[model samples]
Target: MTAPLHWKLVIDTTDAQTLADFWAAALGYEVEDQSRLIAQLLSSGDLPEAAVTEHDGRRAFRGLAAVRHPEDPYDAFTGIGAGRRLLFQDVPEPKTVKNRLHIDVHAEPDGRDDLVARLETLGATRLREVNQGPAGHWWVMLDPEGNEFCVA
Candidate 1:
């Protein structure tokens, strides 16, 4: 057990910042702030202006954005999370098929309906409700960019 390796789930999207914002709100996480790092790279000519964009009034890499658990440890200089995190990166192609892996959001007991509604308000589209006798109940949903996830 070579000390568990650190990892993050990377998602591809046409708009990384927008997806990151949606996920941050949905998961009660915080968006990583890399404005200071971006500024330093830009000033050093290591980063091109076209590769940056404004997100929440702060400079961000145009092709990348991420969200992490609010209490997770992160590198202050780069704003990169060292714990549970999700990185959204821009991709040229659109999602063409179902996801082989998806996130499952488990709500508090008896709070599934409310959670589903809240997620919808945040841009998730409910595809269908599923109820398997004794197996449990859940809602299959799609994120803003059509990524599949479930709420239970």
Candidate 2:
């Protein structure tokens, strides 16, 4: 039998850094810090100045940014996380339809509204509330790029 596998949720976005920032805040995750590696690349002439970008007022990797659980083990040199992560990669076009796979944000009932409000402030738009009788209800929302998610 095969063992369990580990994976990350990869998202395509036009502005990777921005999306990373939002999701990081929403999930209380840490942005993977790769400045050290980038600096080495720059000094070794393996990377150009144009390969870096300013994000959240700090130097960050260009074209892609990722956020990981704060407590996750990671490779300090490469900034690769070993736990839950969301990697935002650059794409040419925007999202045009509902996501076939969507994440459901689950929080304590007392904190659900606050969490939803916080997500809204971070660029998520509330689509509508869904109540499934006994199974419970959730709020359908769209991310900054229009991908669907639920806050419950």
Candidate 3:
């Protein structure tokens, strides 16, 4: 039999912390708080001082940041989520092509518009309206880095 597997959705970004912050607010998730480990590593030279940076006045890994479902169980040592998570890792290339896979955020029937508006205020851009006839409708939007997602 196959062993159990778990995963997180990871995206390449120019600024990991900012993207993590945007998604944390947009999804109502919390930024993974890994400062304690970072401080320990920095002090012991396990991690170089340059390997960490500050975001929102808190220390964070320089190239990566993540958000986790608020209610998800997480490792206190690494501050990593055991359930749903989204990780942003820094990359040099810009996003030039459309996404072949994307995230769709579902909400209460009456909450779509308000949620879309809220995301826009967080730096998401409206792409277009997708109407699927009898299936339903959803708003396609781009994140601050131009990554596409849907509010349905």
**Superposition TM-score, candidate 1 onto the true structure:** 0.98
| Stretches > 4 Å off in candidate 3 | 1-3
User: Candidate 3, TM-score vs. the true structure?
Assistant: 0.95
Error of 1 at 10 (Å): 0.3
TM-score of 2: 0.92
Best by TM-score: 1
The Cα RMSD of model 1 versus the native structure comes to 0.7
CA lDDT, every model vs. true structure: 0.96, 0.88, 0.94
lDDT for each residue of candidate 3 in 3-116, tens digit (9 for 90 to 100): 788999999999999999999998899999999999999888899988999998889999899999999999998898999999999998999999988999997878999999
User: What's the ranking of the predictions by lDDT, best on top?
Assistant: 1, 3, 2
Least well predicted 10-residue stretch by lDDT in candidate 2: 54-63
RMSD of 3: 1.2
| Clash tally, candidates in order | 0, 0, 0
Comparing 1 and 3 on lDDT, the stronger one: 1
Of the candidates numbered 2 and 3, which has the greater TM-score value? 3
